[model samples]
Target chain A: MSAVAYYLESAGIATTGISLVRENTKALRPPRFLWVTFPLGRPLGLPGDAAFQRRVVLAALALLDAPSGPVLEDYPEDVPDLPGDDVFACPVRFPPRASGRGRWGSALLEEIALLRPWYALSRERRGRTTVGVAGTLVETLAERLGALLDAPERLPGTLAELTELKRTLADLRAFHEEAVTAQPGDPPWREVRRLLWRESVLGDAMLTLRDRFDASGDPRLRAFTRVLVPRGALED
Target chain B: MVRLSDLPDYEREHLLDKNLGPLGPPAWVPPGTPLRERRVALVTTAGLHRRSDSAFDLTDASYRVLPGDLGAADLVMSHSSVNFDRSGFAEDVNLVFPIDRFRELAEDDVIGGLASNHFSFMGAGLLPEAYEASARDLARILHRDGVDTAFLTPV
Candidate 1:
């Protein structure tokens, strides 16, 4: 929105951005725009809920009529109590997933389980492989699961390592779960092994993938990999 | 103190002044005094999208293209998981991106002109390479159209 304001202003258009998030307003520089009250994703309103959408839209348009200056409009703080059927109930709910339904709930659970050991170890050793590992695992798992559930792509060499890492993580998670349920002897050692296995798989996969891709000079792929396995945090 | 490890490489460079090299004018611009009277163009990351373009996809780690125009009634907002839609702007929120407001401003003679083309790209990919490439391409386009200055806003 700020960009819009800047563009318009630069083009001799007096513009204002009605930001819903307050933090966004704080980050914005001057000679640009203002903020307003709306939730994160439902900027317009619950999808299909034309009434609320119209009200919000009108409120935004109202800012233009106000005298020049950044104005923060707090429309009746009546945050809608949208029902489940509400199209804009949660923006995240709308996307297509591998399962084609409620995969977000499952993904959230998996991520939490995966991060448990990483968070625990982060407290003991400051270096717990980057969060990118978790992201990579999830993406790889999703892609693989999608392939298994839908269609398979001829597996790329780089992806093979990621699939292996995902398998290793899943196995470790299953083992930890069993150990916890069974009250097995020396569970701590077992847990340590699980953590180590997870870390090693991710770390090794990342290094191999990075080396392979980096050698090719494909900036897009490199960027993708960088997000998957970020490095150089150890450097000062 | 935020650790370097806590920040991504591009972020580190942006914060630590590592990539603060000199920037010249757009490649298409002629040398000498062109910078003085250049018309400015604006591109926003506010997720200002057209009505027809697909909603920002959070799942895809790759960048997606946004629409060019969003008609009078259509709204613009980012719902992409990667997109940090912190602004409380409404879903039909044009004020934030202010495309409509810009039109009004132009009509009122507040600013001299509006760019014929504005660009928007989803901002979730962690690395800046693609964005840098897009920006360079956009700059080239703007220069080709004789845009002198550009106003950039990252949502």
Candidate 2:
């Protein structure tokens, strides 16, 4: 981001930006940047808090007034964690998984069916969903991902297939997160992420797919599979 | 709130290793006008695009145009790196793309005006310099649109 700002400023457009990583901004200093201690994704600090967001924006924009080569400022306020117990467990409990590889696919499909109502309620309530990035239906994506776990070779190695798989995994993640949040209590994303990665059937299938894809011996497939699950999840 | 030190070790290492040296020399251009008189536009690295537009590739350096009037519901994120927290974005697009806040700022005269067109790029899995040409191209568009200031954000 600092690099891009440098390019833009060089092209005669003044730029001011929020730096999530202070070290990067300090190294590749741009024309002007405001460093915030917010998490990786939330550059504006808190979500849905207009006043806090406006303050963050105004603070960053205020950097535009500086007459200098490279100016880096830090946002003063730190976003507080959500006010609630951070522990989260899925509201809907499932029977123990059937033990064989072939049965995992059926288990995944069944899980999808179980979560369908909650996902629908979530979409109706929010009037929007982040589930279509892969451009595939939820059912089809679940089935395809599940199948890859049992028969890794069944996966096609084409670019389109690779892209679809990456996005399908993403969509599935979003679908489960949305569905889980719609049930009873609203959980903090950290706990929800932990639940998705450690306790869910879909999470198991995804990790299985990641392992099989990494061992597929195709460089292109391996390259894309690395990001299928975050590094933090693996550490957990 | 989390700082770089609070991140997982691998992610912290990756971010630190992502430096592209320095882009030749630092470039500086003082704002050509007062904050209230400069036309401001948003440029994001969140890999956001309209529902009708194509999603970003794993290593794409290209950009997508987002009209100023675009709504929060019409945007979706496809950033290659899934390490960041997206719950904020799911709740409010302004957490990452702040278009609504920009609109309010414009209305309140904090900034002169909002550009008719803004830009987005998927900034992961590639070198930082890969964005140089595209950034230059976007600068031309911002220039042509009479934009004197750009507010950038990342995910």
State which candidate has the highest DockQ.
2
What is the per-residue lDDT of model 2 for residues A103-209, given as tens digits with 9 covering 90 to 100?
Answer: 66678778888888888887777667777787878888877777776674586568878777778777888788888777433247676677677777887776776
Model 2, runs deviating above 4 Å: A84-89, A94-100, A183-187, A234-236
Model 2's DockQ score: 0.73
TM-score of each: 0.35, 0.94
Docking class for model 2 is medium
Cα lDDT tens digits, model 1, A1-236, are 43233333333333333354444343433233334344333344343344554455445444545544444455564445433222211111112222333243344345445555534443233211112212334445544433432322223345444434334333233222222222212122222323322433333333444455566566644544543333332222
Which docking band does candidate 1 fall into?
incorrect
The TM-score that candidate 1 achieves is: 0.35
DockQ of each: 0.06, 0.73
The positional error of residue B131 in candidate 2, measured at the CA in angstroms, is 1.0
